[model samples]
Each structure stands twice: as C-alpha cells, then as structure tokens.
Target chain A: MKLSKWALALGIFTSVALLAGCGSGSSNSSDGVTTVKVAWRATGKGDSMYRIYSKKWIADFEKKNPKIKISLQPINASEGDYFSKLDLAMKSADTTPDIVNEDTFILPADAKAGYLEPLDSYVAKWSDWDKFTAALKKGSQGSDGKQYGIPGTTDARGIWTDLVVTKKAGLAADWAPKSWADILTAAKKIKQTQPNVIPFAMGVSTTNGESVSMQTFEQLLYGTGETLYNEKTKKWNVNSKGILATLNFINQIYNKDKTGPSLSVVMSSNYGSTIFQDRIPKNQVGMAMDGIWNTGNWSKDGAAPIANMTKVLAFNLMPTEKGQKPGYVTMAGGWSWALPKNSKNKKAAWTVMKAMNTKQLAVTRALQEGTLTVRDDAAKDPEYLKKPFIKEATQALQNAHFRPKNDLYPKVSIAIQQMVESVAAGRKSPSDAAAKYATDVKGIVGDSNTDTQK
Target chain B: MDASNVIKNKPHKTQQQKTERRLSVWLMLPSMILLLIFFLTPMILTVVFSLTNLSLTGEAASSLHFIGFQNYLQMFKDPALATSIWNTIVFVLFSAVIGQCFFGFLIAFMMRGKNKTFRRIIGLIIIAAWVTPEVVVGFCWVAFLGDNGTLNMLAHNLLGMKPVAWLYTFPMVSIIIANVWRGTAFSMMVFQTALDDIPQEVEEAAVMDGATRWQLVTRITIPMVKGTIATNIMLVTLQTLGVFSLIYTMTGGGPENATSTLPVFMYKQAFVSYQLGYGTAISLVLLLIGALASLLYMKILKVKI
Candidate 1:
C-alpha cells in the first residue's frame, strides 16, 4: 500500500512540474527598442550561409532603424521538420516569429491557418514589387486572392544527363530526347553497356517529399496533358489517363526495364545524396530527373567542382508525351519570405523583408545558392547570366508550370508521393495506385471539390 | 472516581486515532490535486480532441466540430495505419521482449561467477549506448548501416562482397537491432542485480544433484528471478513503444512505410498531416496497446496492482 501510494504521488508530481513549465514568453517592446523575431530553415551548409546573410542583413537594418533589434532564429532541421516546427510555433501568439522563410507551396495553407499576414498592403507600397515576375507573385498568392509572401527564387525541373554515359550507350553527346520513348531508348542502351550503373535516377518515394513531385512525377505528369490540379474547375484531377500513364512510366522504368535505381534506394531518406554526390560525379548514372539546383551543387564555389561541368553534364527540358504542342514541360517551385499574423513588430519585420528581397540580393543569392532568378531585373543581371545552368534554366522558365497553390495541395502532394512509392515498390499496380490516389485526394479536398479528368 | 477517569481516557484515545487518519488524508491531497490538474486533464483533453475534427488549419482549428468516432472509424479503413500497427508490434516483440529481456538475461546469467574486470567492462560498454543522447545514437547507426557506411565497407573489404543498403532492405530489423543495442543495458543491469540476490548455496545444491546447465537455468535460475523478468519486460516494452526520434532520424518511417511504428504514424498524422484529431485518436490506440502489454505481463507474473 505504501509503494502504490508513493508511485501515484511521484507520477502526479512529475507531470504537474512538467506542465507548469509549458508556457514560453514572447519578446516585448521596451522604452525605445522593438525586437523582431526573424526565423528561417537552415540545415547542413545552408545554416552557415543563412547565418552570414542574416547577420549582414540584420546589421544593415539596425543601422537604418536604431530603435529596432533583430532576433534571428535559425531552425536547423530538414525541410519537413522546419515546416512543421514553424506551423506549430505559429499556432500560439507567444511562440510565433515575426518574419519566416516560408515555402511557397505552404503559403496558401499557412495563410488559411491565419498564421500568415497578407502582404498585399505592404507590396502595394513597395517600389520594387513590380520587378518580380508575375509567375512568382502568383506562386506566393493565397487561394483567397491575397498576397501572403514575397518569393525568393524559383527552380525549374528538367533531366540531367551525363554525356560520358550517353556516349557510351552510342547516343550523341548533345542528345536531347523529344519524347518519353526517346529517353527510354537511351536508358535501355545505357543498361546494356554499363550494366552496373543506374541508367536513370528519380525520386519515386515519400522519402524526398516535394522532390518526388516536382522533379520526377510532375515533370512526367505535366507532359501527359493533365495536371494534379485543374485550375479552371478548381478541383484536383485524379483517375485520369494522364495520371495512370505517369504511374505506368514509373512502373516500366522500375519493374519492366529495371533501369532505375533500386526501389529501396528511391525510398531511402538520404537517397538524394547518393544521386547528387556519388552517382553523377562518378558518371555512374546515365540520366536523372532533377532540378536545376542539382548542377548548382557542382558549381565553381561549391564543395565539389566537376571541372568543365558544361562539357561533362547537359540538361534539356522534360519533353511532352508525344512531343506534341509546346514539345516540353517543366514545373517551378520556390521559397518565400512571409510575415506571421501575430508579429509584435510588423513595421520592423517589413523592413527586414524589404532588405532581404532586393534585386541585388536576388542576383547574389542566385549566384551563391544556384537558384533561378524570381525577379525580372535579377534575371537580366550580367552576374546571374554568367552562371553555368542559370541561363538555360531561365529560358526554360517560360514553359514552366506552377503547382496548385490551394491549401490542400500539400496533402495532395504527399498522396502523390505515396502513390509513386507504392507503384515503384511493386506493392501496387499502376491502376491500383491511381485508384488509391484518387480516393486519398477526394478524402482530403472532399469529393465535391475534386473532379475526374475524363 | 477511577471508573469515570477510565471512560474519559478511552474517548480521548479514540479521538486521537480519528485525528491521525484525517492527517493521512491531508498528506495525500497535493498529489491528488496534481494528478487531476496535469495527468487527468491532458488525457481528458486528448479523448475530447479524438472525437472532434480539429486540425492545424483549414476552418477546423477555428471552429472544431464533434465528429463522433469518425476519425476512429477512418483509422480502420487506412491501410497505412494497419501497416504501422503491425510494424510497431514487430518492433516491440523483437526489440524489447525477445532482444532486450531474453538476450540481456542470458548475458547476465553467463556473467555470474565470471571475472570482475571483464564483467565491469562489458557492463560499461552496454550502458554507454543507453546513456548517450538518442539522436546521436540514431546518427551513429545511420553511419554504421548506410550503403557507404562501416558495415558495408567491412563487408566489402573483409568478405569480398558488394555493399548493401542495410537500412533500406531491412528497415524493421535494422531499427530493432539499434533499439536493442541501445536499450538492453537496462534489462541486463536489472537482471544482474537480481542474480546477485540469489543464494549461492541453492545453486551449489542443484549442481550437486546433477542438474545440467540448461536445466539449472530453466528450473532454478529463471524461477528465482521471475519477478525481475516480468518487471523488465514491462519497462522495456513501454519504452520501446514510444521510440520516435531514433527511428525518425534513421529512416523517417520510409522505404515505403516499412519502418513506420505507432509513434511515427501518430507524429505523421498529427504534425505532418496536421490532422490533430486523427493523430490524437491514434495516440490513444498507442496508449491502449501499452496498457494492454503491461496488463499481460502483470497477469502472467501474478503481480497485483
């Protein structure tokens, strides 16, 4: 009886002590100075770059506005964790940061949650707002037709080819496939010659999140003349020939031809490193459906310098299904700067935003981070044009497609990732995966909000 | 005069006993109040949240509505949830019950009457993994099991074999090994302490009666420390069921949801999907499973309360 009573008492005491420390205090304005809480997702080497940039930006802002202090918080985590952490922090007024670097894909959802303050009024006052590309501005606009963020950079997705492997497969060094069949023919030949190398690499699993959607699945799905979302109907498109054909494409590469990387590698969380850091450099991968930033990793200033990258590696727009009208398709995704709804120092936060989202900064970031320019002025900058892949990707941006910026797109994107993984793993057939995807999408957006492509 | 004094003393004595009982109840008040405010309150809130359509966003958090078992009903239809439940069971069975308790006990049993220096070294090594922070352990295992990791390198150089992605091909088994590697120290230490308490005379008598090694362990040593075995299993199983960061860091429940356990699933639903209501409902299921496992151990051990 004594032991039971003691255990109960100990349990209760420990729990209460934990709860008593739950609430955290937010920054407050004092006599003359206001503190602005600035937060961004910085993982791996990006943390140091963000830190350096933020320090300079903060110092510049504080010099101009002496009464305001910048409290920069760098969340060192993966992109997925960063999103969830930012969302959780924004749920409460006390924990919310003043300014955050929001993924453009999540801008609509965050705005819907009332975590983000619409920047329409601020953008209307800003002089350089008109300098941003219309497509980028649209990417940051919420479903309610309100501007929620200022986009930083947009990345164009395409196929990265190793000329060495292509030449070995008896393909021309400047080979650019006009259709899906042409790409497959090359992959087949590479498999026959190299035997050990992965003929093609694409993220086909839930492990890589948006990478699987933009880099692989969407690149293919858009070429089929169908999209995940129907802008005209404002409903997600599922159960369509386009989606099944996309899945079949994945199935053929993974199962029939076995030219793709092992499904297990595709499903591994760190598989991106294997493709970028190992396979491509070793010329062990023939072709890869990846972003333009992939080549940026091999930039002159980067950790690895593939000497004469322009000679060894080449890129082309992902071709449409039958090389039909437009002939090629690409999808654009990017990050944005957003203000939290409960920011204590909104004016100061706006100053930070303006400081960070400048044409000069855009040019610098494009060169430094290997990101495509989001602003028209930055795209024309000589420094930006000099970059290896930037010139080519900027031209492809005209043919680029943007994902649906609705609040449900994040969940829908995850469902697409799951569908790709299931089919790639041979756990489900293309038809079964498509069916499951349709059901998952319908459940998320409601059946009334979705439509069959037919 | 003597009779009147005796009656007055008896009444005073009874009053003193009543006051002592009242004091005992007062001593328990702070604990009861703490339990009501902290433990009971959050559990009740979870139950309430499980019945609603609350989410991180999308008109749900602003105006949550009661859906009455809708989330629970949907759980049954989710194939991924079923896979998570199965993975969690496999993880607990392998990592906790069989791996930690049985193997740890065997190690402890073998170490009896062994060299003190050797025993201390082995104990310290095992305990080191447990004492290290969970995230560090996770990263260590990733490096050890990665395609280009230590295990693969050793296999390539030593055995003349090709490198393999250990975490991908055997996601469940890999994590189980990691959990066991990190957690078996607790069971081993506990069982070793229990073994020390066993009288040496009884074991010597058993050996004199011609009892073999296997028979001695099964018939004598195990029966003697049955209580420790039961308690160790209960503790280890509960701890393993709640593992999140280690698995999340290593695999993030990937290789196609093959390593997603209950906690990982709950986190994905609650935080990733932002479906707080559904995630809480799944958490309650995890809670129930933990309670059930504890109860099973208690019943088998004949442990009361």
Candidate 2:
C-alpha cells in the first residue's frame, strides 16, 4: 500500500514537471535553413489588411532566398497592449522575434530598455540607406545616437472632409482651412445644416490614448508654433502661450462651439474604429481631423470601402494658428522595421528586415495604406503621387512636427491626455487645465527640467 | 522472559515508523508545492515589487531599484486614484451589499417552503445567468442598455420615448446594475442551501406562537443563518472588488475615465503607461482594502473563526 502511494505521488510530480518543460520555445532553425520570426500588429479590420501586403512581401523574399524562412508573429491587440506584449516578448531571448514592426513613437523607450538592436552596421552597408530622408532617418534614431530602425512609412495628420455631408451643409468641399476659425466656421455650418450628423470628429478621451494626443490635440498645438519639448533648451515646454491657446481651442470646439462629436461617442473605448470605419464612411460625420492613413480606410480593399472614394472624401492641409509663418501644420509618427536585441538569427533577421523596407514595397504600402513613403525616392515615385490625397498629405509634412523622442514621453503623454480630457469634459477651465498640466509635468520630470512660457 | 521477544519486534517497530512518515509526505506533497509556487511566491514578489521604481519599459525597466514607498506617496496625489476609490466603494456597496445580497436572500427566503417545481425553475434561471461568462454578460448588458438596444427599442416602440444613452450617461449605475444581475445567482444559491438547512420544527414552533411573518424572520430565520450570511457577504465582497472583465468588456472604464475602478486604473498604469511599480502599489492597496472589508464584516457580524 505504501509503495503504491509513493508510486502515484512520483508519477504526478513527473507529469507536472513535464508539463512545465513543454513551454520551451520552438526551433527557429533546422537543416541549415533559418526561420526568421517577424512580429507585427494584425488585429483590427483596417490593420489586418496590412497583412495582405506583408504576406506578399514574405512570399517575394522567400522566392529570392530559399535558405531564409519568415515566421510571422501577428499580435491581435490594441496599440497599447501591443507595446506592452512586445516588450514582454522581447525581454527574453527565448521568445523575442527576429524582425519587429515597431512604432517610432515607442522606439526611444524600447531602445533605452535595450530591447532593440542598433542597425547602423547593417544600414551603413545597404545602398538604399541614403534614399531615406534626413528627418525620417533621425526619427528612427535612438537618444544614444544609434540607428535603431529603418523607417517604413511616415504619416501626416490633417482635415478630412466628407463631401457627402459638406454638400449637405452647404460648405465648399474643396476649401482648405487656412486657420482654426475656418474649421470652426465650417463645423458650425455643418452643425446648423445637418443636426443628425457629427459636425467634427476628434478623439479626446483617454480611451483613445495617443490618438487624442497626436492626431487631435497635437495637430492644434503644433499649429500654434509651440513645440512640446524645446529642442534648443532641452526642457519640456510645461506651460506656454501655445499650450494655453491650444487648450482654449479645444475648449472652443468641445465647449464653446460644441462642434466635436458628442462626449458619449468620443469617450468610448472603440471611438477610433467608430469614427474611422463607421462615422466617416457612413456619411455621419461632416469633417474629421485625423491622420493621413485614414485614406486607406475608404479604399477599394479597406475596412469600410465605399464605391466612389474621390467623390466622398476630400483631404486638406491643417493650417497653422491664424496662418502663421509655416502656413499648414501636421504631426508625423512613423512606423519602422526594427531588429530585436535578443534575436537568435541576427543575419537572417537583417535580410528579412531589409526586404520589408524596400523602395518598391514602400511605394506600394504608401499607396495602398494611404501613408507617406519614408524614402525620398519612393515619395517622388509617379506611382505614389497617383492618389491626390497623398499629394496633399505630403504638403502637410513640410511643416510637420515629431513627438519628443524620450523615455519620459510615454509618461508625459498620460498627463497631457488627462489635462486635455478634463478640459474637453468641461470639468476644468482651459487656464486651470494648463496650470494643472504644468504641475503634473513638473512632478514627472522635476522642476528644473520644465520650461514655462507666458 | 520478554528480552528475546523485544529483539524480534524491534525491526517491525522501525518499519511501522517509516511507513507512517511516507504516508504524510505523500498526502501533503502536491498541495504544499502548489501553494508555494502559485500563492506564496507571487504574494511575496508582489509585495517586494510594490516597493520598487520598477517600470515595464524604457531605461527604468532594465534596472529596478527600491524607491521606499514613493509610489504609495505619489498615488495619493493622483486624481484618478481618488475617482477610482470612490467608484469602487459605490460599486461594492450598491451592487454587492444591497443589490445582490438583499435580492438573493429575499428570493431564497421567499422560496423556503414553496413548491419543489417552482424552486427548481427559479434556481435554473438564476444559475443560467451565473454560468454565462462575465464577458458575455457584459456584452449582453451593453446590448440591452445601448442607445439602439432591445431595452431602448422596446421603450421607443411601446412608450414613444427617445432612445436613451444608458452607458454614456450613467456609467456607474449601468455597471453596478449589470454586476448585481450577474452575481445575485451565487448569493441566491448560497442562501438557498443555508435556508434549507434550518430545522423545520423551529419555524413551525415560531408560527405556532402569535408571531407575524416579518417577526418570525427577523427573530428566527436570520439568526439561524448568521454564520452563512457573514461568510457569503465576505466571499461576494472580495469577488466583486476584483471584477475586471465584466466592466472592461462593457465600458472599458471610458467616457473620460468615469467608470475606471481600481483594477481598470491598475491596468492603465501597468500595461498602458508601463509603470509597473505604481500599478503594483495600487494592487496592494486594493488587496488591503479587501482585507480591511473582510475584517470589518467578520468583526461586525461576530463570526466565529
């Protein structure tokens, strides 16, 4: 009886240990052929369509190099979840993928965390390295002065008008807003004419995360000719005339003019998809201040594809505050192809990463996805400029601003979201919100690190 | 005379001792190991991690240093923390304490001496709601209370009323009601078992006297199941405090963070902002709150052991 009990206990222990052992990572290499693992976001409807391009890129690469096999690690999640999950995965050599479809917004943090490998050595040897514009190249560089990634596509944010509603509202579909007043006037006109449709769709809730900061809030702040971080002073612009003016503009739209979408619709977690796929395509929105990539949303093979794209939507430049020195303004955040530091197949990974960022592929992705090509040559390609919206979006880039590339940026962004969200919710006045923002940012980066402007 | 017999029995005595030792080891081994790995280690690590400036990303992520309760201090200054605590308190009080417990006990009490078929039918419906996944329940409530959902549709068609924005307008009320609906079944089932265990003669004796229904219940039924009531409350309170999925699936702590409870706030901090230390501190505070509530329940109810 004792022997039987001992035997059972040992058997249970062994089975449990074996179960634990089963979690060992799979083989990436076999029979002299390397399998390079690639990680990218392929979750939502519009995002999943990017996989069609990636699949073709993989097939073409495989045909060229039979010894190299690409294994795709598609993460089906929101942007924030993807960032966290990718960081968790890349923390260990056993789980990290070889190639990564990285957002440049988080590249500084990732590089600073030692999760990404510097690709300067690889880029120095590549002939197409110089084809990438200086600004685009700088966007992919880490604070350590190391080239961390190759720019995939950079996008600009602007005003996207729904002609279906523009015509209904008695507004000119072809008109470009030269100032904040122009957009608000158009929004009010739309509001008066079409009571059912949303006058202006802008993300302001924390649920929309960076979409509110970059696409909505920053678009206005950058236009005010104030940088989020002072490049020369090397201190964050905690409170400034530009910030106050920007918050006042947010106040005007959300409170004074009441042109933005209802707080209920704007505050929901799925507002991004709601505005992009439903409101814009369903002709329920008059004017949408959004990123350039929304052009793909209404394409033939996009998320909410409509019959006549040109007839339905019109892209216009986001003009500066009162049409300043740089007349139009836009904020650009580009995605890039990065190599994980813990990648097992380093050589094979570089080959796959290179294939992912070619001149032809960049142009194709830009046209298909309605994002600006990072490469100077690809941007000028006749095939790329075929889309008229793409041409207009490119002009917005002439006065584009990039987010402060630092580790503290992600933390600071939360404070900005809170400050902006509070004002939008009518919980605080614009001046009060800006003052709170200054205090919040001061707490984050310390007193000496912040610069206040009157 | 027994010296030779004593020598002969020595080997058997040793054998018996060895067998008894093996028996205990075999019985306790699996559970002890499981407790160490799953429960103890994680608890200790969470406590340790809550003390550090450990981040999930950036330069701070790679090298975690002890910040000595700085996260705790900083948490006090955060406006979101205050909102989350208030929301959590209101959610727990209404949904669990008053809503679930009250309705569950009422139904269970009402059915105490009722027909067998009636009890089973009610039981089945309640269990069905409980068995459905939390996410499914969330989605169902969202559909039912949504602007163009069944509830609004019925209200519009029947009463000629405009479709009300239920979730957006009243996030807390919406989540609390849905949570009560989902959790009442557990409390009901517990109360049913407890109520059934009460001696029939005791109730008969109470009715034999000149006692009203309310008097009989307050004096007898409640007194008899005091222990079970306390235990049930403790269980449901802790369970409700950790509710993440149901609320996350429905509101996503949205409409400008109005519905963001402690769990939602912790998720935003840890996963979204990648502030692991601050998030861990929030979780620990949440755990303490749970512990404090349990202690309070046990103390007020005077539950023995």
Q: Supply every candidate's count of residue pairs whose N, Cα or C atoms clash at under 3 angstroms.
A: 0, 0
The alpha-carbon interface RMSD of model 2 comes to 2.7
lDDT tens digits, residues B1-305, model 1? 69889998998888767766655565666667668878899999999999999887655655779999999998988988899999999999999999999889988988898999999998899899999988899999988987678898999999988878787778889999999999888999999999999999998999999999899888999999988888889999999999998998888887668899999999988877778999999999999999999999898889664
At residue B26, candidate 2 shows an lDDT of 64
CA deviation > 4 Å runs, candidate 1: A1-23, A46-54, A262-265, A277-279, B1-38, B157-160
True contacts kept of 2: 0.45
Worst 10 residues of 2 chain A by lDDT: A43-52
For model 2, the local distance difference test gives 0.84
Q: Name the candidate that leads on DockQ.
A: 2
**Chain B TM-score, all predictions listed:** 0.92, 0.92
Q: Cα deviation in Å at residue A158, candidate 2? A: 0.7
| Model 1 share of native interface contacts | 0.31
Superposed by TM-score, candidate 2 places the C-alpha of residue A205 at a distance from the truth, in angstroms, of 1.5
User: How does the DockQ of candidate 1 come out?
Assistant: 0.30
What ranges in model 2 sit over 4 Å off?
A1-12, A15-25, A46-57, B1-18, B158-160
